[model samples]
Target: MRLRIVVLFFVLAVGFVLAPRAAAQSPIVVVSQSLDMRFPRSMRFNIETKSNTRITVLRLTVWQNGVAVGARYSPAFAPSQHVRAGYNWSFQSLSEGGYLPPGTRGEYTWHIEDDAGNVHDTPRAAYAVEDRLHTWQTLSNDVVRVSWYEGDAAFGAAIFARALSAREFLAKQLNIQDIRPLQIFVYASKQDFFTALPPFSAEWTGGRMFPEYGVIMINFAPENSDWGMRATSHELSHAILHSKIRGTLGDLSVPHWLDEGLAVYNETSDHAPDDQFERMFQLAVLRNTLIPLRKLEQRFPADSEQAQLSYGESYSVVKFMIEKYGAEKFAALLNIYEKGAAPDDGLRQVYGMNQDELENAWRDEIGARSREISTARLPTLAPRPTFEVSSPLASPTVLPTASPAPTAEPTRIAQAANPAPDTAVPAPAPALPASGLCGGVVMLSGLVALSALKRRGGRDSER
Candidate 1:
């Protein structure tokens, strides 16, 4: 009987040892997470894991404004001696495969699978990635608003006027009367400006429009104030075009050429016929490289030089339509787009001509020959402010305000136009926690940076 008791005790001890592992399998502990906007294609995340585990699949999926932009996956490994696996990230080697555009916010989650086939998932947390160098100052009216840094209040006022004035003119020209909240972000420097953009954004791009969010990001250098406002007007034209179209039509997509040409035509200044555009335009004509107007409806050339020439061609073609056909016809063509009519059908209905005839007439009028045309799918290039169009309904946006004191996370301007209700994707079933693993988790952020400054009060006491 004593021997039997001993055997039973041994079995009980073994069961106790294995019971915890079988009954409760806690998720992987998140040590820290961050995204360096400088490299938008990569995600830097750290995790705590068991020593014996090998991470076979580590995936990250990002959802922007409720739209799943894309996902990136990687293989990662961790050491048992050190519980921390530092910086396991998915590098976006493909052009559009894992690219994340800047000046946007999204919810991202980590999905991890271990060598033993155990799976772990993190809750989708909201993240806004934009420039956070200085505290912002905002100036607003009913229809339009502007926000800048402390010393840029004057620039903000100037841009405010520019935004409203351009809005009035575009609305009158388009024969539309509707309002969408337009928020402008004015960064103080070029580096700060680039910091707010995706990697492939062009160097010459001074401003961009996010129609999905109804926001504009512009680099406002005090030294180049005049040119900065011009970019402001240029981007505002795009904002007006996109917002008015959405307000009028439910959610119709427009062509690139018409979209860009109208934005360019609204620019405050005009160049001579033989100016900057002529150089690239004439070269494309000499080489026979201009994309057909119908083909250009999709995108321009991937080559920057050829792309600029495409812009010139688009502007010239759009300008010809306006001059020869008149703004009334331009409005009518927009009406067709607003109605979601087919592009060629709209071309035939509005202008009584096909795209080929239109392209030939425009090229002939410009006294230039057409180029060797290729129909390859062009990667969406910079300065075009390419993005997936969101629903016309606006989601309740959060505009972040920062205090003089340090913040754990940079404040964001969550302001949205025609904001819609939030929609959250359901997460996977969570596993029960291991005994000690159920303890508190701390998020690593900028809250611990030490700050000390000497000061003298009015009473002459040093502080």
Candidate 2:
């Protein structure tokens, strides 16, 4: 009985240690779908394993329209660290027609087997084929064509399309027609994207017009977030502004302030106050720092603190101009610039005012508005004393009112009242003693000696 009890205890201990290992080695299956996945195009599916066991072979089977279209077994693959393995299965279009027929939809099953003969099958996954043409469409007028990718393509196309639309609207608003078309490229993944167009390292970049191809490359990879609406608008603004004015005006050479301001003005969205221009203006106003319009085009501080201020001031100045002078005048200025005229000259020609005068007007307008705001926000103060008081005098005697004593003169009473002036005479200027002179010389000699010693020490160290 004692031997049997010991044997039972040994068995229990072994099971306790091996149970977790067995569990950890068990197979696990997980599935995920892309946020922008659409039908009829190549969609990627990832199959993974959770066990440490190496998967020598795996098989994937896909079904569409109640029929198996793809059924293939993968060759042996080594299990990766973290005991997880992944396979990306892509479905291509069935025919060269580029459109999948209607009523074509079905599920897919992935069968995975590990080298240890552990079998795992995925829960049935489904997909449908739809008409590609109807899914993606673009609208074009006589001058420019605007199309977008909708199925599994990058979101940059939608952004670019919106930007073009905004440019067209603004151009018409400004009556500056003859806008040029911008061809936008949309990539599915960052890897595929950078493979085509090299990466850009700048924070915010513009003016990528290639003289050889007459095409501008405005990369949106860095700004490819859901919150990148303003960035998209900003880039598109550059494209439109250049296309419209550069050809006619011979390079427009507009100041950075005006350029950035116009871009920001066009970039405003209706969603939130955190949009580019508003945020910048509010920050500049709060921080009491604004970039002057004349110096806005040149390099200002690019630090986060200063950039925020710069953007705010630029937006405010542009908003002030538009609100005070009207959009027609602004548009006229653009037209003049497009005709190869200097900004100052263009302002004078179009608005009957030079650049300096316009800038001054804008500044004065902002100052007045700021003053009004300050006055409105001023704190209320307590009222002043109301009544005068009478003197507490008893008898009404005609006493002479002593004239106020003359302001007293400062006196050095501590020095002497009547002591001998000669004796008190400030001691003769202390004669420079020989010891003092010798002491000065000795100090100088010590400094010279220290300097020499330092020089010798430095030379010795060098040697």
Candidate 3:
């Protein structure tokens, strides 16, 4: 009876000590639900301990299609403290072996284990397969290629090709095919583009145009803004123009008006400040500073004031030429100018009109329109604000009259009648002496008289 009592006490003591260890080794329980998304999406799982007991070692094993794919673990934990949480695992359908066939279903399961080697299996997470478009990539050059981010490959490819074709056409027109091949960057979302160029702000304007390097950066933010197309076309036009005139004419001093006018003409979209043109026109008409076309090339209103006028006039002039001369003639004019010919000469060669005549016509058209608008019932007129016109570097050439172009057949004339795009006055032809004879005629006569006197003296000596 004494031996039995001693053995029973020893066993009870051992069992008491082992019970706490067994309880501390209990498995961790994990719960999870399958992810569902209406649109293509991404998900992250956050695992956290709810109990105060520190889990010394906790691990999560992920299974996709019955195969172990990824695992995440917690850092070392101490008693009575919830341990470090983690989210270092991810599964993408596009990843290899992660994709399921369309109309088929698949299951994902997560298993949680604790330091005691106890395992808890989560309920099966279900997912369905859906169709996705394969993105297509086009190598623009050795360093760069365009790829579709979200749109259909066919549509993206079409837009890319169209941009390239347009650039090529402009280059050929400007005779600058040697410019480095330009790369086009297309993004599917504004957020993706934010990584490149920041969102447009009115204060932040202007872009780079490096014809020598053959790169053009286009920010398609505010994806719907016409400014994007206009800016792209404008920069590309500069590239084409630069490539053509790089080394010619001792720096090829193209005036701002001509450069910007050509850009506006080629742009397929309108800019945000387009309405400013009509406003300037009305103001100029009222203020009597509406510059005549003849004088436009030589002089402009002061800086900001003239900038508005210059743009308005350029748009109107280019529009008129396209309407009157037709697209073919307009294109021919550009071709001629791109070939190192003076703009005035190119215009005269193509249009058969002098700068003076064109200016008069433009002024008359504007004046007539203004008069007609005034005659019509004017809306409750708002008091027009008076702002000082920025003075131009030089006074604009004034027109003698506002008249339309002559309807009669053009007369063949020797002098160029057209003006440069920036100058209203026609460039004077190389000057000629008043008389047909060269300036040396008087000297030649003096030489003849001296020769005659010498011959007479020689005759006397012979006598």
Best by lDDT: 1
Q: In terms of TM-score, how similar is model 2 to the real structure?
A: 0.42
lDDT, model 2:
0.42
Clash count, predicted structure 1: 12
Better of 1 and 2 by TM-score: 1
Alpha carbon lDDT at 107, candidate 2: 53
lDDT of each: 0.53, 0.42, 0.40
Q: What is candidate 3's lDDT per residue for 182-278, written digit by digit as tens?
A: 4444434434432332223111122333333233434343332244445456556665555444331123323334555565555553222344455
A best-first ranking of the candidates according to their TM-score comes to 1, 2, 3
Question: Taking the tens digit of each residue's C-alpha lDDT, what string does model 2 give over 1-463?
Answer: 9999999999999999999988765464443322123433434445555544665445444443311123333423565422333334322322211222222344555555566666666656665443243333444433333333333334544555566555554554555443433433332233332232212312222212221111222323323433234544554565556544543113434555676666666654431223333555665555655555555554345344455456556666667776777776777666556555665666677678654566666767766232212223334222222111111111212222332121121111122112221122212221111111111001121222322233223211100
- The model with the greater lDDT, 1 or 3, is 1
In candidate 2, list every pair of residues with a backbone clash: 56-76, 249-340, 256-297, 280-312, 281-312
Measured with C-alpha atoms, the lDDT of residue 415 in candidate 1 is: 28
Better of 1 and 2 by lDDT: 1
Cα shift from native, residue 264, model 3 (Å): 1.3
The residue-by-residue lDDT of candidate 1 on 1-463, one tens digit each, is: 9999999999999999999997667544455655554344455555554423655555555544523223343334442422544343322433223333333455556665556665667776776544445677788865665778745567778888877766665555544344445667876666776665544554444466664444677765565556556556667777656654543214435677777676656655342231344467777777877767876776665544555566667778888987888766777776666555556666777898666767877878777774444566444322222232332221112212321122222222232222121122322211111100100000011111211011011111000
RMSD to true structure for each model, in Å: 17.1, 37.5, 31.7
Worst ten in a row by lDDT for model 3: 434-443
Q: In candidate 1, where is summed lDDT lowest over 10 consecutive residues? A: 435-444
